[model samples]
Target: MTDRDAFVARLGGVFEHSPWVAERAYDRAAATGLTAGTVHSALCQAFRTALPREKMQVLRAHPDLAGKLAIAGKLTADSTAEQASAGLDRLTPEEHERFTALNDTYTKKFGFPFIIAVKGLTKGQILASFQSRIDNSPEEEFETACAQVEKIARLRLQSMIPGDENA
Candidate 1:
């Protein structure tokens, strides 16, 4: 197998759970050498090509508002989701009562947990985005989520083994 062929097969394993993501990863590796920068750029390029229509398919991948029982630990609730959840552990009884109210309100306004790719964001930043985005129209929110999905898929691709030049 040439580099591209190997890239597709091996990457299939990495994204076995998400086919479109596997395809996107394969396309990227084939066109660019499988180095760090190339992997990152390939994600932005390939995702922009494929993601807007695809993000809705993966929206279910995000965690619940309370960060309870999520797939892959982080997929449903990204890092800040988990952190916010952990904060609940530290809250006093009064704070916990207030948190429950806020959580319910947020969930009612947004169909899913407030999402931000927490890889490069501070907890504060995540909070800001969460509040701002909560008011977005469903269409706008869907687009935003799709964009987040692209960023997330790119982060995922970075950790995958470099695609083989030959299979």
Candidate 2:
């Protein structure tokens, strides 16, 4: 594969079903050297400056945490692993029900899934965050979700590219 193609192939899913982030990032990275930091900055810049509609598309692209896609074994590989890391893959029935209800309510309220970067969180922590964020104003929640998406992308990039978290 060409360098750009390979770059996109590896980093594409950093933004949950949004390969375009990687593609656009690569266009920028081609001008600079592709290091973990440069790639991450480019990717986030692409995401951050996206149109509101595109940003919403990225948010909506995410699966509901521990919701139907996971139960049906349909989550992307990255999502599945990240959810499992947070113990979301092993929820008790009651917890599962709670997550399902929260997912529904959050989606209805915010027009997108409740997205937290689940890498270092526990199930209870995630649930607590979900419950609290549900009460946020729509504008507040939208910005919060976008920020979380950026965090998720950073973590994903760090895993593969191995460099500064701030980058």
Q: State which candidate has the highest TM-score.
A: 2
lDDT of 2 by residue, 9-58 (tens): 99889899999999888888778777767887899899988999999999
Candidate 2 lDDT (Cα, 0 to 1): 0.91
Against the true structure, whose lDDT is highest? 2
TM-score of 2: 0.94
Error of 1 at 2 (Å): 9.8
RMSD of each predicted structure: 6.3, 1.4
Q: How high is the lDDT of residue 136 in model 2? A: 100
Query: For model 2, what is the alpha-carbon lDDT of residue 147?
Result: 95
Summed backbone clashes in each candidate are 4, 0
lDDT of each: 0.53, 0.91
User: So what's the TM-score on candidate 1?
Assistant: 0.58
Question: What's the TM-score of every candidate structure?
Answer: 0.58, 0.94
Candidate 1 residue-wise lDDT, 1-167, digit = tens = 87656665555433213455556766666566666456556645555566544544455545543344432344322333444444532445564454455556666765555555556555446556666777788878877876776565555555554453221
